[model samples]
Target chain A: MQKIINGKAYVLGDNIDTDQIIPAEHLVYSLSDPQESKKYGQFALSGVPRERAGLPDGGVPFITDGNYESEYSIIIGGSNFGCGSSREHAPFALQKAGVKVVVAESYARIFYRNAVDGGFIVPLETTEILKTALKTGDAIEINLNTLKLTNQSDGQTYTLVHPGDVLPIIEAGGLFQYARKAGMIEG
Target chain B: MPMTITEKILAKASGRDAVKPGENIWLNVDTLMTHDVCGPPTIQIWKDEFGGQAKIWDKQKLVIFPDHYIFTNDPHANRNVSILRQFAQEHQLPNYYDVGGERYKGVCHIALAEEGFNRPGTVLIGTDSHTCTAGAFGLFATGVGNTDAAFILGTGKIWEKVPESMKFIFEGEKPEYLTAKDFILQILGDITTDGATYRAMEFDGRAVYDLNIDERMTLTNMAVEAGGMNGIIAADARTEAYINERSSQPYTVFKSDADAGYHSVYEYKASELEPVVAQPHSPDNRAVVRKVQGRKITKAYIGSCTGGKMADFVAAARILKDREVKVPTFVVPASTAVARQLKEDKVNGKTIHQILSDAGCVIAPSSCAACLGGPADTIGRSVDKDVVISTTNRNFPGRMGSKQAEVYLASPLTVAASAVNGVITDPRDAMG
Candidate 1:
């Protein structure tokens, strides 16, 4: 696992639910297919503006239609990120779309587990002050070894908590790999 | 150290005498459930990662339900079932309830309990967030994602953290008009949606014990809405009897220590509570039913794991027995067993099913119909600009069918009463 990551951040608001991350309508594609990654990546945030059930009509999209992966690799979000639904596809889609780390004030339990168990993305916890300090398109650098995040754009530094017990899974590239190494399953 | 019920269950699953909050351990799952929406992908990932020759850790423990998106005729929806059917056959899975068969169950959460997988002192994981419903039986249960479920499919084990426990003591007797839905909505309203995130919600007190198993399940079912890792109630005589009727498996009954540590404790007087509804967009955006009265609606839906139990239907039937529904009302049984119970249950002289049918309610098949906003052909789906009062969890934007359609979540009684009046009517008003 990368101990340090430097990337641009995409900011999202509170309660970024599983439907908003990846709607049920776009989940028709089979995960068994070889092109599953590309299919999921393309539809990663398609529901951002139009699919949320009861919210307002429009907001700033975190991942636009264009090639966003090239410009951003981190997602900065408010409280209760991934609050609804136990769909792993939320994190899977973000990982497939090239999101590496998700920094949130807090996360829904299942999403935090999925991010760690699937090793699809790293979920880091920070204070509300850090959430307010960061902005979309800001150049951020995170050092897991040091438990700190640096905003290169503004020369600000913030403390972050590395999700414990998740480091081993990330180092092994996912739960299955970690399980194999731990001898819980046949290698 | 003294342990909460959640900690105790996790400790047993992880082969420990005791465990603490935030301690991660490998859990030997007693059961893992996957539905049609996530089942195919889970199977796919299992095959991809574990190889074609890998065998399931335990066929008896792996339950598959093709509940969501099953009634639709769309090819994509049909394909999901076919995949599950093929996988079940390939694995010779004993628990796969294929669609169009006598064994087909309805919602996975309800069927899990009905089929006896929700034994006390067991660790249950499902692909749906509502999997927490099983915790009502005095167990530790929570939802996982496709990848984690796939891992369980191959290993029969999951890595989990012991969540902190929050104790909710509901004092006093619940009013007749207030159902578990209203109680949970009141808690959600007070705590907001994320109040209990990453914690175990341990519900107890005289009020919770007074509730039947179905109503207890409702409390646990919506715990996820509060971002709770799981919701649990201790197994008493009622829970034991309920499990004994459905299952023969030997199980332990675990309870929290008298001095067990809790992250927080919330005490409520059940008698003081009123019928409440979660307003548009969020389950935590709640208001008293009296405040939202006369809000016109185009549709009324009464089904889903949260509201499709036999007791829920009986409550709705009590209100709609003699009245004709004013709007397009739909009643979907959560499972075939519930539907059968409805057919067999008599109110006065007519079966519950007959009363509902007589009242112009569309009695659909037992499935998660229109809950996840199924294909275009899904029955009871909300259309453009439709204001629907549903009993399903989650009214997020585009939740039912159309982004433009608005959804208000309420109790089955409230939904039935609202259906009769073509508006959001409080159950108390209609009961009179």
Candidate 2:
């Protein structure tokens, strides 16, 4: 299935930390209901209200029926996505908030690996075409099977292929899902 | 053939004749770690996902430290400790340290290093990103997620891909005033923060070899700060001498082949470098210490996995001996072991803790404390617009509470000197 993300982009300039993705303070809360975590993004910027209920223009997008609105699906960030700390909650919060894929110039190794293992995060290469084509509220379609990322605004397309067993894992809904299908887990 | 530190650790873990860059293999982790916050969730995941059993690869191979919120005055933190205690008992994990009444050890990285968990030619993994600190002892260490930590706890095995190696070559004489912290900060400034993502940084050259084990460990400890999975300094005679002083454990020597190829290489001359500090908001925001001089501080702290080594404490104590802490200073040794060493050296009351305590310093147990806000050490409203010059890793906003407050990263000596002056002063001034 190919889904296009359309929303005002709350683009990060570059080099976001796990603490910024989700503060250590939020980890104190119960992990059961993710909607509770919708307030998570508000804490990213300091001095701001703890509950910035009004969604940022490119806040987060949801392809699923029951997800946050203005909620962005695809995150177009600068180099080194997830640059600080090894908190899995960083990726978990992003996934729970309906971030389908992250398009960045590069990714921190631990973050890249953790995102892959979790399964929901699909990190695409940040090429010039994709970068130039992307803006706040511009739509993007990312096809998992073909690794095709299209910027709907300029009709620009990019194919990302890297040497790894990661594609199948993302397609299978992350490592656990892939492991389950591979008979690593008991039915 | 001289094997790189990475190859040596891999060989030991995999029982291979030799290993090189760019090979994926499962290696036995010499030491595995989890903190309070990450540990609780990983334990929950282990029970829910992997079932309750000590059916891991080895019983003696795991180590757990409750350093994150050891001084937590929060009710939720207290509850988490109880949950951790239950998990500890069920798993029979022998190494557990508590806080308050208990003899609290410092942060995990410092405790492990002091207790000899980190050694050359071994691979270590911790749930904390700063686990990369073990790289200082020539061990190949990296941080893992709670889920992966759970799998390791359940199975005692870790999956890893051989990474491309980048060599940081340092040459030249380090001035007496210059320390490893300055060297590393300079390197971070040179390479920027995201410089070595996904690569293993192998420290090389004459300047690196000159560093003592503690100093070298400080260099490797913050490798994650550069976004690298791990950092290694090839074990040499200096390393061998240091390891021999600490433990009788047998260590297989590991050094990169003279002709070993690195994917990328960088060089720095230590003599040309001066004290560098990471300004508030990011570790990569580098500036000369001279630029940030005279910034008044409300708190000045010196301790963390990265900067709380024995050497750092001793250095801080020396600068703070006759001086006093004007702000509400906190001088925590990294671990109980470091505290013991300070005591044995007779530098405790005469120089460090006592002097600072007499000067209104709030002495606390060795833990992540204010670095990660362990309740007892978090910031209060009174601290607004105040500055902090701390030796702990990361100077991100609200790290020490108030968003309006400023936090500066500097060496322990600089931090201690600033405490004495009640402002951000250079250690050079205090030395005189």
Choose the strongest candidate by DockQ: 1
Q: Which ten residues in a row have the lowest lDDT in candidate 2 chain B?
A: B373-382
The TM-scores, one per candidate, come to 0.94, 0.88
Q: State in Å the error of residue B340, model 2.
A: 3.9
Evaluate model 2: give its lDDT: 0.70
Candidate DockQ values, in order, are: 0.60, 0.43
- Quote the chain B TM-score of every prediction: 0.99, 0.91
lDDT of 2 by residue, B1-432 (tens): 555667667867987787776777778777787777778767766666655443555656677777776555577666667877786687676776655555456688877776667778878899889998888877888998877787677666666777778888889887766678887777788787888787788888788888888888888887888888898887777777767777777666677777766778888888887777888877888888788888788888777787777788777777777666787777677787776665556464374556555556666656776675435444321156768888877866556656566788888878887888888887778886
> What lDDT does candidate 1 reach at residue B24?
77
Per-residue lDDT for A75 in model 2? Answer: 71
Residue B415, candidate 2: alpha-carbon lDDT: 83
Interface RMS for model 1: 1.5
